[model samples]
Target: MRCEICGKKLVEEPLKIKVDGSIMFTCKECSKFGKIQREAPKPQRPGVSRSSRVTKRIQRPREPTEEVIENYRDIVRQAREKKEWSREELAEKIYEKASVIGRIESGKMVPDLKLAKKIEKLLNVVLIEKTDNDIRDEMGQSKLKGSTIGDIARIKRN
Candidate 1:
C-alpha cells in the first residue's frame, strides 16, 4: 500500500486516519495530521464465493416489461365514446387537464403506464401489453450481446 498524503510507498502496515471528516489510509509519519482510526474487519459470508455470486447473477433471466399498445389512441377514444363521456369529463375523472386528453386522442401524446392503467380501469379497455426483454435484428435473430464501446467507435468512424 501507498501513503495517501505523502504518496510514498509503505513498507509497514498503513494507518487509518480521519482527516477533515474523510477516512484515508495514510503512512505513520503523515498520520499526526489527523486522528488515528481503527480499521474495521470486513465480514465474510460462509461458503459464498465472489465467482459464484457473479455466475448466479449472469444466469438470472430478464423480466418482461409493460408497454403501451400502438393503437392506444383509437382504443381510448372508442371506449370514451361508448361510455358517452367527453374529453373534459374523462380528464376530470383521471385528475388530468382536458388538453392532456385531447393530445392523447389526437395521437400527439402517449400515456405512460400509470395513466394507461387508470384509463383502462375507468374505461374498461386494454391499453398496455407485457413484452419480453429480448431484442431482435432485422433478420429476426435474437441479439443476446449488446454493442460495446469499440463497436460504437467503429460505427462512428465509418
Candidate 2:
C-alpha cells in the first residue's frame, strides 16, 4: 500500500483511520492528518458470490436541447429596458458583471446556455429554443480504428 497524502510506498501495515466522516487507510507517517476513528461502518452482506457483482450499464448519447435565437442582442436589450433596469442592477440580479451584461446586450459576446436561461427568466424572454425534437445528422467520416493516444504522443527521432 502507499500513503494517500504523500504517495510514498509503505513497507509496513497501513494505519486504518478516518478523515472527516470517510474511512481511509494511510501510512503511519501520514496518519496525523485526521482523528483516529474507533469503528468504521461495515457494509451489510448476505454471502453473495463474486461472479454476481459484475454488471453493465447502457448509455445513450445526449441530444442537443437548446439553441440561441438569431436576434439575441435586440431581444435582451428590449426585455431589460421593459423592466426599467440598468446594466449593474441586471448583473446583480443574475450574479454577473455589469460589463458582461453590456457586451451581451451590444452583440459583442454570446451568452452560453446557463447564463442565457438566467437572463431569460429575469427579463421574461425566450433567448433559446429547444431543438431536441429535430436532430442534425451532418457528421462526416469516423476516426481510424487502431491508433491510440500513446501512439500519437511518442516522439519520432530520426
Candidate 3:
C-alpha cells in the first residue's frame, strides 16, 4: 500500500485519518497531521454514486470583533517594564513564542483577541475593545469618511 500524502510505499496497514473532514488512508508520518474519521458505509444501490450523495457545505460569515486599542504596543511595553519583566519572561509566562511578544511590542504584529486577552490579564491593561463603528463596519454599514482606523488617532508634535 502507498501513503496518500507522501506517496511512500508502506509495509504496514495504511493509517486512517480525517484531514479537514475528509477521511483518507495515509502513512504513519502523514497520519499525524489530521483527525481520525471513521469510514461511512457506502450505499449498495446500483445507480447511486458517492459524489452525488455528498452535499455542499456552506459556512456563515463571521463578524469582526475586539479591535486592538490605540497605542497598544506602547501600553504593553510600558506595562511589561513596570513589572520588570523581560520579553522572554513575558513570552514564557504567556506560553507564547518570544518572537510573538517581540513583534507585538514593536508594533510589527497585532495580537489576536485571545492573545490580547491574555496580555490584558497579565499586564493589567486593556488591549482590545469593541466600538459601535467596529460592529457597523463588520456588518458593511460603516459611514465613516476615514478609510483607516488610524484616521481618528491624534498625533502630537513635540
Candidates in order, TM-scores: namely: 0.46, 0.44, 0.44
Task: Please give the RMSD to the true structure for each candidate, in Å.
Answer: 14.2, 17.8, 14.4
lDDT of candidate 1 over 1-158, digit per residue (tens): 99999999999999999899787888999999899976542324544465556665555536546788777887788878878999999999999999999999999999999999999889866676656534334243233113222322333353
- Model 2, global lDDT: 0.66
**Candidate 2 worst ten-residue window by lDDT:** 140-149
Q: Looking at candidate 3, what is the lDDT of residue 105?
A: 89
In what order do the candidates fall by lDDT, top score first? 1, 3, 2
Give a tens-digit lDDT track for model 3, residues 90-154: 99999999899999989999999899889888976666755434346444345332322332242
**Highest lDDT scorer:** 1
lDDT, candidate 2, 60-131, per-residue tens: 224555777666787777777767899999999999999999999899999998999898788766677645
In every candidate, how many clashes are there?
Answer: 0, 0, 0
Candidate order, TM-score descending = 1, 2, 3
| Superior candidate under TM-score, 1 versus 3 | 1
> Can you tell me which runs of candidate 2 are displaced by over 4 Å?
1-62, 135-158
